[model samples]
Target: MLLNNKEHLNVSEYVDLNLELRNLDLEEKKKLIWPVSKSVDALMNFWNSEPVRSRQGYNDKSECSQLCLGQLCPALYTIMSDGLKPHLGSTFGPIANSVWQVVEASSQQGPLTKTLNDLVQKINGEDFITEGMLKFHAFVFGLLNLRALDAWFAYLCTRESILRKHYNDSSVLTRGRPDEPRPPLPRYPLIE
Candidate 1:
């Protein structure tokens, strides 16, 4: 099913599917084996496609220019045309999309599964929106208890979501002067 730029799911229907998925054992979940085969098929294509380079209507200020995906429509997305969405981009997208397709394909799944899959992939693989990139998807899974994160984290547990450790420039503040010591500031706010 085609998903609108903005879409939603029925929580009631999804709850049942969640139970079905819950019934699956570790081995089954590892293989991404869900009752919904069609959903898996569609998700394969969704993860590979890139973000909308140009919106259907011709407008530079359209979603094409916004940094984020349409989630923050009027907020103006700073993401590059080729850049990935934060949080769920490169890594999380494919993983998240896999789960989305499963949930959506179920009898209890929602119609917006396709849209959710695409958006999740965009957030993970393309932009690398994990906490490292200061994206919301990172916290979405961490802070919130959305059922969506299940498949993503499941994938993480099975295949092993690998994080390459690379030492780069320090984000810590550097002393401008080599010899001069930095002045100490009060840790607490001063009373008026």
Candidate 2:
């Protein structure tokens, strides 16, 4: 039986299929799995495909130009091209398209700094409007989340540096500099 009308799934049939899928044996489920290599190859090809690249239409002017994939547009276009739009329509559709507008507006700025500032402001502004009716635009935009990760990394590095310095100082007092180590480690040492 035809389970789809053009692209729309026959929901009742789809539910029945899902129920049938749940009753499958381990071997039957295993037969449905694609090989890992094929999966990876398919993903790589889709990510780097010509049409997706052309749709990105990136014109980076940042100091990290061309190398910087930090911008929002490319990431959105990559994941939401024609093939995936219908699937994402009800879910990611609202948020993605709303963020896309911020990307588009910020792209018009004369300088990279201005563009970034405008983008951030638009996303973070409480008054920001979108067709999707999304609230907390800043949270949805994900730039702030990226910045949080960066900040967390910086904190971790700082903590690591402090710990390394403490270790070196303690080692210097007990033994010597890291380069001028005197004693050999014991075979079954409890602590170094």
Candidate 3:
């Protein structure tokens, strides 16, 4: 768990070492440039991962926080990454890489990189790199490549609608709403 500002500053040397190594790993990852498709694929994987999908709260629209990339709320990345940490490590490399990949792939430098650059400075911060800072980077990265993120969200919404419709249709018999004949399940679009 991450500490608040005061507690983090007083953390032990061992904890500080681990945090340093994690930050270094993230720094090294930022150096690589990935294709937009590769980054999208990685982002989709992170989105579909059990940890992320479970927190989606998809049943109710009001519960939709991290459902789409457009919802770039500050905690979105943290919620997604915290869930992935057990699988992706403390660095949250897969998600971070998605952002870095987009940033590198961009033809023009995006303003969002400023936050990322700031975080680079904070690697040596007295309080050191906090989880919130990492998530902010993720947010900025998502912001930078919103076009790709939007495409994914569009696809996600379409897919969800199809799936929900299919479920409702299938449940017609069980729900005792058999006013109409049952329709076959719709084929999902093949994700490239």
Best by lDDT: 3
Candidate 3 at residue 92, lDDT?
42
Off by over 4 Å in 3: 1-72, 87-148, 152-192
What tens digits encode model 2's per-residue C-alpha lDDT throughout 42-100?
44565566655355654424312222233332432332121211211234444333333
Candidate no. 2 TM-score = 0.20
**Per-residue lDDT of candidate 3, residues 1-192 (tens digit):** 454434423235445656686577545433321233344455566556676446644453343323333344332333222212122213544333332222233312346445444533443353643554454454454444454444432332334332232233322112222344444533323311
Model 1: per-residue lDDT, tens digit, 46-115?
A: 4345544443554534432232233321111111111121223355343332222222222122463444
TM-score for each prediction?
Answer: 0.18, 0.20, 0.19
Descending-TM-score candidate ranking: 2, 3, 1
Better-scoring candidate (TM-score), 1 or 2: 2
The segments of candidate 2 whose C-alpha lies over 4 angstroms from its true place after superposition are 1-16, 19-63, 69-73, 80-97, 101-119, 122-146, 149-192
Cα RMSD (angstroms) for every candidate in the order listed: 24.1, 22.2, 24.6
In model 1, the worst 10-residue window by lDDT is 164-173
C-alpha local distance difference test of each model: 0.32, 0.36, 0.38
**Model 2 residue 25 CA deviation in Å:** 21
Q: How would the candidate models be sorted by lDDT, starting from the highest?
A: 3, 2, 1
